[model samples]
Target: MHKRVTFDNKLLPYLLVSPQILVTLVFFFIPAGEAVVYSVFSQDAFGIEINFVGLDNFLFLLNDPHYLRSFGITVFYSVAVAVSALIPALILAVLADGVAKGATVYKTLLIWPYAVAPAVAGVLWVFMFNPAVGIVAQWLRAAGIDWNYKLDGDQAMALVIFAAAWKQISYNFLFFLAGLQAIPKSLIEAAAIDGAGPMRRFFTIILPLLSPTTFFLAVVNMVYAFFDTFGVIHAVTLGGPAGATNILVYKVFNDGFIGLDLGSSSAQSVILLLIVVVLTVVQFRYVERKVQY
Candidate 1:
């Protein structure tokens, strides 16, 4: 049975949580409220005049072909990043779990990439893939492949996806490794005694036990790909090569600051928030059913 401890001073509970509540109010709720208010109003780029234009901004976005294209691009990019990050991390975690010696050193080296800032990671990739002087670019040229991402839309999108996924792989590796380590050795030994091969034991037992961790990582990676990848894209592609890598979050910044379309940018933010909320709800509602714990 679970035991509950009651506080003698009821106000103490509220006081204990007050700091986090204040932070949420200051950072999240306040900005969200401002966005909702601004989204319904039209404002000049100079901010000299403002006029109420309820739903006009959202309507314009709904009808804009560029916005529609961006919506599709963002979905594809997010999926690619999540999949690419998760697969390699899982493989690395599995390999590291089997190491009998130097495991700590291997894990430490694998996790060090997570400490790198997203922009710095992007810059690192950019240097390696730079068309003029990059080592990888030179290798591609030697292989008779055109390696310029500056002018190629598809190449630019692929490059940003690689940069973003590379940054996230270390984060996923930590969780996957933890989950792998938590599984019981008895279960694997029992399966082996029952004539189960390594591959069969992994597929039937280990993978099933990892469902919960996999589900959690899926949600986190999706959110990260959607929102946290802005710095990487900014540093690397700047959402260019004909706007191929222009995801929603970056578009919000570009529209608001560079284009100076406050109303539209606010509306886009609201919409992006809604999309993430809905996706999270869907995952919790449906995807969680498959998780073991």
Candidate 2:
């Protein structure tokens, strides 16, 4: 049974949450409001002339083939990163859980990448795959494969996806390891005594219990791929091989800052926010039904 603590002083409760409220207002609501306003208006790069454009920016985006291509690219990139990150992390967690020796050391090594900045991770991957001097590139070339992300759009997209997935693996591993450890050993032992094999116990007993953690990670990884992968894209591909890796967040930055299309950029940001919000809502609505807890 959980006890519900009642606050006698109403003002104190409000004060306790005031800081968070203030932060949300300042950082989230304020910027979102600004984006909404800017999205509806067109302004010169210098801010000297402002004009009301209404829905022209959004309509332009809808008609623009490049923008549509970017939308498709973002969906594919997010799914690839989430799946790649989740599967390897789950495998590593299961393996680590079965280890009888040096478990802490193995877990520590797996987690070290999570501490590295996304940009640094991207740089590391970029160096390993660089066409001129990269070791992996040399190996690929030796294997009769032309390895140049700089010149190939599909190759550039794949490289960024790998980098992003690699960066997120450690985070997913931590959660999965924790979830695995929390599962009762008695259940596994009972199943084994009943003549269940390792694979059967895992799929029927362990995997079902880990569903909640998996679901949570799915949402987090999707959000990370949508928004937090900006650094990886920026450092690795810069949305190139002709904008092949231009996911929505990076597109917002590129359009707003580089292209000097503030209205279009703001519209893109609004649309991106809507996308993430909708994705999150859909996950919680439909996916949570599968979670045991």
Candidate 3:
């Protein structure tokens, strides 16, 4: 009985973890498997006929001009948002780190936006950009800038990109702040004693130390920009004027749910998943080569 009791105590942790393991296998793996299975198949009008058509959907998407356009737009959006968000976030993080007073207040104000839902953020931005009554629209017109998203594809893309980037600043800032806080003050002091200017110290010392955090945020923000901003695109642009805002995930939503072309949508989703996986791999590989600590 003593031995049995000891064995049960040792096995309890595994038992506790089993539920999560079971749930993941059932919910995540099963659906992913189904998606892969369906991607190779074709569905007819009745929606009941799922015939295995082996790469037909993939080939069709490859040849489709609209898919090509959306793919380009998606990549552009992700890169633009990543670059725009990273710079400002780094600046804010540094500023927060240097503040001698009210740092908490500044940090709180900066981080507040992260709490807002992307759909809500999109709605707020759209209201601010409203041509008739939006404060931003009024300011733009007064400044002699033509900024109507309804008529201009460039303006539409910019609006969506800005909105997406704006919400992301808070998330990036949080990571950056943590990274900045983690850096040893002794290193900064050493750099200062060695006659390193603030900019030089940042570029050479601080940036290198922060590379791991930056890399993490890069991958995370890229994934969010690609997959999670569906709410923003849906609420704000709905893939907008002449399919200009039709990004990959939005395209997936449009095709899979709205257009009810499940097989093609699954194919598109599979492609998007592959792109994300590839990007994640590249980031890890690049970081492994350069990250010192």
Candidate 4:
């Protein structure tokens, strides 16, 4: 039987949790409610006028070529970011886990990037890959490659994807390392005693144990790529080289803040919110089933 904490006073428990409830109300529900409200109405370029157009904004978005393109790009971008971040992180975590000495140092160095803001990380990468003065850019050019993300749309997408993925690596690495460390050493030893080599032991034992961590990271990384990389894309590509990097979130920003299309932006936000919710629910309902305890 599980032990349950007994509260001295029911009122005391409510008082302690009230603050968190208030914060959620203020920050999440309020904004989400406002987005839903705004999405149904049309406002002139000037914010003075408002008219309820009912599903018109959403309908407009559904028919918009640019919005469709952005949605497609976002799908591709999220997948790329999640895969790129997770694979490299898992590799690094495996390598670091095997280090008998200086393990802490390696882990610390790998995790340092997680502390940096997405925007700051993007700027750092842009400078390092700037076609004119960036060292890597110069090296690439010297190797007879015409490398310039500023003018090449595909290159710009690749750059933003790389920057987003790189920033997320530290976060993924921390979780992957923790998961790797938590696997019981006895299980591995038993497998080894049965003539299992490193690769065989890892594939048969370690990988199955890691499924839970991988699934969790998949959900988190999807969300990160969908929303949190806004700063990185803003600073690095600004959805450009011809709007080629205009993922849905960035498009929402552009339409709402820059283009001053409040209704459309709000509608997009609602759609994105729904997409995330559905994806998370699907993951929990289906993907979680495959995760090993």
lDDT of each: 0.93, 0.94, 0.88, 0.93
Give the per-residue lDDT digits (tens) of candidate 2, residues 192-251: 999999999999999999999999898899889998998999988999989889898999
Candidate 4 lDDT, 1-293, residue by residue in tens: 99997877969988999999999999999998999999999997887999999999999989989889888899999999999999999999999999999988998999999999999999998899999998999999999989999989999999999999998999999999999999999999999999999999989998899999998898899899999998999988899988789999998888999899999999999999999899888889988987879
Q: Rank the candidates by lDDT, best first.
A: 2, 1, 4, 3
* RMSD score of candidate 3 (Å): 3.9
TM-score of each: 0.96, 0.96, 0.90, 0.95
What is the Å distance of residue 159 in model 2 from its true position? 0.8
Residue 177 shift from truth in candidate 2, angstroms: 0.7
List pairs with backbone clashes in candidate 2.
none
TM-score of 2: 0.96
Write down the TM-score for model 1: 0.96
Give the clashing pairs for model 3: none
Better of 1 and 4 by TM-score: 1
